[model samples]
Target: MHIAEGFLPPAHAVAWGVASAPFVVHGVRSLTREVREHPESTLLLGASGAFTFVLSALKLPSVTGSCSHPTGTGLGAILFRPPIMAVLGTITLLFQALLLAHGGLTTLGANVFSMAIVGPWAGYAVYKLLRRSNVPLMVTVFFAAFVADLSTYCVTSVQLALAFPDPGSGFLGALGKFGSIFAVTQIPLAVSEGLLTVLVMRLLVQSSKGELTRLGVLVAQKQARTGTETEAVGR
Candidate 1:
């Protein structure tokens, strides 16, 4: 749901620009800590990001002519952390704009806000929350990704309503339209995202034990001063 320039009035775009700026700055700072925490997973993150970029570009319609795609940041966040996904999110958006012209340059911040910040963090929170108990990994992943996708569309709808406030539109009116636009598309897409995330995580676990360990997913046997020990101490 990448918003094009001039889709909203000048006043609205400017307002969203203002609202989106802080998230971009917060996201940048958060990413640095993530890199420091999981130094060896750079390659994995990059690969995941490339997949995400491609996934997001695969457009399908939500409301007839109006199209949308999976953000994929939710999966990244669940596998790693939300902060690392933020970097992936920004890169995906930038590449989509520059390489594919899928989204506009001027509305880049708005895109970042909707897809990167909202999607990843929301999904991560849901995953972590659901995983607190003994819930099935697949089930948690499905719910987390579903909520994340739903959240992105909700945010997009809100921003659009703010930008293009109909003279007669109130909060309920906005909610109704937003619900109508996203409800159908998000459901199947969320299920797909969850399954894909689980499969990718499974692959990483099988292929590179070292990388997952470095990224802090696997907990190996404790040695007094090994990587695991050091990470535990750091934490």
Candidate 2:
């Protein structure tokens, strides 16, 4: 959910911008390291960024007051890591803001914070945790993407609630109202995005195997498969 241009008060906008600056810097550094260490990863990184850009630009109807869309950073984060996702997400958001006028320059920091930094990292954490616990790959990816998409809207709702509190119930009440509206529309969309991300990952496993192999997904997936086969044989 984009907060739209000039919607936030000056203080909130500036504060968000200040808050996001460090993450953006670190993202740039992470991207630099990835390219430097695994030059072949450049293609995968670009492709991940493109995936984020395309999915994010498709803004759905606002079931509530604000428009909703898939952050798409979850897939990027899982593939390229959260630090790289911050850079890619910013670039995608900036592209839409400048070209399509979908979002806005004024609210870029807030959008990036939610879509790029917050959601992606949260999703990545979920993915890593699930992977460590021996979860199925598809299930892990589904939850990662699902959490990432939902978390972005959750953060956006909080941001909006903070700025525009309910006249009677104050921030807490506003938070509740905004969160409810978001949940209704965004829940289904989050599930859809999660499935789509896994589908895309499957496609990449075939079409972009080399690039993904460079990133260790192919090897990990192979190990998982072998382990499953061994367990079945023992059974």
Candidate 3:
């Protein structure tokens, strides 16, 4: 999801930085709270971040003549929450840039804003809105991933427009091009990502019933056991 260096103007870069600062701060704060409240969540966050870093680097064909990859922010948001996922995503992006040069340093903030901030938040909102037990989790994952991927592309187009405000290269034109490009590629990618996320979630739910408990998604017997242990120790 890197916009490639020089695609965006300096003004656009600065503008995105300014716009994303508050969200980044919020994400950090949320991550901190989650870690403190449920230390095991950090393990899942790190695992997911590592997987995202690896998964997103795999190239797939795109109509725009550039390769695209799954952002995986939607999966993170669905499993955790958007703000915490944003922080985890930023960390993963940082590692990708440093280790693989998948993205440039100059455009890192813009990339994070588009993929981590926009994608995760939008996906989480959609998933929450459409996802009742009545709906299949896999179906919800597909729709959320689809919307999230498209939303990231839309944010990237706007970021590019901010950088290139030439009359012929207006934001609308940028948006139109992005809409077409994503329409061609995002569906397949979204379906793959959604299926993968659901599969992983199913495995996790089965193997680690205490996990969502650690996330405060539910109370598990482990908590009761821990409490009993604490009382025994106290007595």
Candidate 4:
């Protein structure tokens, strides 16, 4: 969900920007080093940014003052880590606000916090945890994308609720109201994103296997597959 320009109070907006700045700064340094060291990664970086823009640009009806869409940060977060994802997310949000008018400059910080910072980190964490647990490749990918999409809206809902609490029932009431809107639209969207990401990841594994391998998308799965084969051969 995108918080529109001027949707947040000036103080809140500024606070979010301040909070997001350090991460963005570190991300810039990391990305610069990465691109310099491995020129091939530029393509991967551009691809991730494009994926986020295309997915998030498709706005659904908003609840309160913000719009909803599936965030495509899962793969990027998994590949680039949270710091880099934060940088890419900021760029994506800024461009969408300027180019697509999908989001707004004033609310850029808040949007970044929800969609870029929180969503990517949470999704990446889930992917890593599930991988360590020996989850199947496709299932891990699906959950990572799905969780990332859902988490973006969840944070958006919280941001809205905090900013505009219900006068009668307080934050919880407003949170529920804001969150329900996301649940209705974002559920199917999350599922679709999960499936689409899985397909794209599989294709990447085939087409850009070098990059995907270098990025460590399915290393655990690969190792596990080899182990299974070794066991079967022994049998």
Candidate 5:
């Protein structure tokens, strides 16, 4: 969800910018460290950024000053963690704001805070929780992507509500209005994004098993099995 340029009050805009700066700065360091330490992961990182850009760019008109779309942050968060996904999501949002006019420069901070920071962290938390409970990998992936996509809109609704509270009902009313409107389109989109993420992960599993293993997405059991199989063959 991208808030239109100049739509939010100046104070709100600056406040959001100030709040978002630290996460983005930390994300930059995380990304740099990831690239430096695992040069082979460069390709996957690029793909994750591209996925976020493409999916988020396919926006649909929604509430005033905002739109609905799939936030492809879950896959990257799952693979490289939320800190790294924050960098990818920020780059995607910035480029879209400049070249595609998908979002506005003024609202970049708010959008980044929602889609890049909160969404990934929330989704990754769910993923980790479910995985610890022994959830199937694909199922964990689906819920993670679903939560990531939906949570961005939820945060956007809160931001909009806070910026423009309803005259009669105040902030709660405004939040309800915005949240209801966002849910109309975002729910299905979230489900679609979840399924799509699962599909992409399946392909990655088949084609980049080693990479997934290194990222800890594929876990250790498969690697152990492969090693055991190799030893058996040798025997």
Candidate 6:
């Protein structure tokens, strides 16, 4: 979700900027370290950034200042972790804001906080949790992408609600209204994103199995083969 330029009050914008600065800074460092340590990963890193840029740019009309879109942060978060995804997300948002006018410079911080920071972390958390519970890889990938896409809107709703509380009903009421409006479009978008992410992951599984295994997205071949045999015997 991209909040339009000058949509948020000055005070709210500054506050969100201040809150988001540290995460972006840390993300920069994380990205730098990743590149320095694993130069081979640079291609995949670029791919991840491209994915976020392309997917998030496909915006649809929604709330007054914001729009609904698929957040493509989940794949990067799953592959490279949230810290690196944060940097990629920020880059995508920045370019969109500058070139497409999809979002504004004034509201970049709030948008970054929601889509870049919270969305990736929340998705990655769900992915890790589900994987730990032994969920199938594609299933985990789907939910991770689904949660990432949905969580961005949830945070956007909160941001908008806090900034423009309903005069008669107040913050809670505003939150409910904003949340509901977003959900109408966001739920379907999230499911669509989830399926798309699963498809992408499947391709990666076939073509980039070594990299995926190195990134821990897939188990080592030996381990996977053993697990498959174990399941066969169990059946």
| Candidate 1: tens digits of C-alpha lDDT, residues 1-235 | 7777557667666676677677667767766766787676667767778768767876755544566677777777776677667668878888877887766677777777778778888998888787767587667777777777778877877777766555686766776686677756676676677777677777777898777666555656464437576874664
- 3-37 in candidate 2: lDDT tens per residue? 78888888888888898889999999989988998
Lowest-scoring 10 consecutive residues by lDDT in candidate 2?
A: 226-235
User: What's the true lDDT of residue 225 in model 1?
Assistant: 39
Off by over 4 Å in 1: 33-38, 61-67, 214-235
Query: On residues 1-235, what C-alpha lDDT tens digit does candidate 4 reach at each position?
Result: 8888888888888988888788889889988988998898999899988888788776655434445578899978877787888989999998889987866888898899988899898888899899889998789989999998899989889988998999999999999998887655687788878987898788888898667655666453556667544543542
Candidate that beats the other on lDDT, 2 or 5, i.e. the better one:
5
> Cα deviation of 235 in candidate 1 (Å)?
4.9
Which pairs of residues collide in model 1?
A: none
Question: Candidate 5 lDDT (Cα, whole model)?
Answer: 0.87
> Model 3, 32-135: lDDT tens per residue?
87789768777787877765776687677665575678887777887777887788778877877778776666787898898889999998888877764546
Q: What TM-score against the true fold does each predicted structure earn? A: 0.82, 0.88, 0.82, 0.88, 0.90, 0.90
Please give the RMSD to the true structure for each candidate, in Å: 3.4, 5.2, 5.7, 5.5, 5.3, 5.2
The lDDT for every candidate, in the order shown, is: 0.72, 0.84, 0.72, 0.83, 0.87, 0.88
Instruction: Tell me the lDDT of model 3 at 66.
Output: 55
Worst 10 residues of 3 by lDDT: 213-222
Q: What is the lDDT of residue 23 in candidate 1?
A: 68
20: Cα error in model 2, Å: 0.8
